[model samples]
Structures are given as structure tokens and as C-alpha cells.
Target: MCVSVCVSHGICRSLSLCVYIYSNTHSGGGLRWQMAEFTHLVVVKFKEEVVVEDIIKGLEELVSQVDIVKSFVWGKDIESMEMLRQGFTHAFMMTFGSKDDFTAFQTHPNHMQFSATFSAAIEKIVLLDFPVVAFKTPQ
Candidate 1:
């Protein structure tokens, strides 16, 4: 599980604190025990002018076919072109119930098909997988 706090403009400080605690307790796991953690944050970048809707549809289909993905989020970077240059046009935040679930996602046929579709529009892709450390409050 993961917790994301919005620190964007106009968010109240108290509300942010409340959300922080809620996110940590629910998404990041409660004080007693940790929830199932994911081992990676899979991010994909597409070329400019690519059909985003089609890619999202493909991803949705892939997710439906694969049981390994416990939860996920996909979206385009709406910040700026400079941010886009940093890397990745589309980011897919996926949570696996276990390492085994991640492994299954790697080999799943639907994933392979999705990759094929994704590659067609994407000029480049960057994949990063990080090991999970102890959970902390979302910054």
C-alpha cells in the first residue's frame, strides 16, 4: 500500500495533518501491523502526441486480466514539459500483494500484449523498482 498527500496550494495545514495520519494508518498500514507492501513503482513514458486514451484502455484491460495487481494508478504528467523531460510521460503506480504477485505480473500474457501496444506509441520507457523500507508518514 502507498499514501500520497497533496501539498499543493491552498490545502489547509490541519487538514493535511489529518490526511497524513489517515493515509499512514490506512494506506501505509496502521500502528499495530503493516499491510501488504509493494516492491516496485513501475513508470512508463510515452512519446509526445501518442494516443493516451488508447494506452489507458490497454492498461485497464491488462489490469483486468492480471490478478497480481492488487491496486494501481495511471496518469499523464500535467505539470510541464520540463517535468516531462525529467523522464516518463505516463506513470503507472502498481501495488503487488507480494513478490510472487510481482513476478506473475512480469510473465503474464496480458502484460506482454499490453507492452506491445504500449511500445508502439512510446518512444522510450524507463522502469524503476525499489525495495520497500520501513514505512514513514507521507511528506
Candidate 2:
């Protein structure tokens, strides 16, 4: 977890916030996502009646159709002792090269369309845009 992203962006406005780092390597092979200078993290908590699977599929489709997103990945929470999570269960982290790129993504018609449905299902959300400072990789 990388705290700097959340802190620098004032996401959750705390240093102790849990930060999830994006993986460079692809799950199927060694191919890596194009390295970007910035990363945007989005965590969402859906309402009780919201179907989690539907939300995941919508995100996958939205990202697949959006070129502005340099890379995208998501997963569900397993189990954690940390209590700050506040019942948030799903997270999506996407990487983009520039603020302009991210802005474009935010305003994209496709994204806007997707958000209508996504937003209605979400109960709460925490978003963080992280600027890469320094990272270590396997040697």
C-alpha cells in the first residue's frame, strides 16, 4: 500500500489511509502495463441492494472502451483486520499518463454514461490520484 497517493491528493485527508499499489506485470504473462507518471485510485462501497458483479462488469466494459485510461485493474476485498476500511468492498485503480488524459477520461461520454449507473449503486466512494515518486521492482 502506498500512502503518498492518498495523502498528496488529500484523498481521505490522512496519512494512515490504506493505499493500494498497481502492479506492473500482467497476470497472464510478463507483459507489463505501460508505465505512467501518475495513477488514479478509486474505491467504492455499494449499497446493500447493489449487485457487485454488475458493477465489476460495467467497469471492465467502460475501461475497455476508453482509450484515455492507460491501464486498468480491479479486485474485491478478501479479509482484513484493519478497521478504517469502513465496509468498503471494491476498488478500481487506473493509470493515466497526464492530468489531461485523466480529465478526458472523467469527461468522456462513455465514462459519463457508465457513471450514471455506477453512481446510483454506490453508497460511498474514495478517490485518489497518485503521482509516482519512487518504486522498487524485483531484481
Q: Which candidate tops TM-score?
A: 2
Q: How many residue pairs clash in each candidate?
A: 0, 0
How does model 1 fare in lDDT? 0.62
Best by lDDT: 2
lDDT of 1 by residue, 1-139 (tens): 3444444313222322212222335554544223334555656666778888888887888887787776678777788686546766677877675567788788888887777777788776777654334344345
Error of 2 at 127 (Å): 0.7
List the global CA lDDT of all models: 0.62, 0.71
**What is candidate 1's TM-score against the reference?**
0.62
| Model 2, global lDDT | 0.71
Task: Name the 10 consecutive residues with the lowest summed lDDT in model 2.
Answer: 9-18
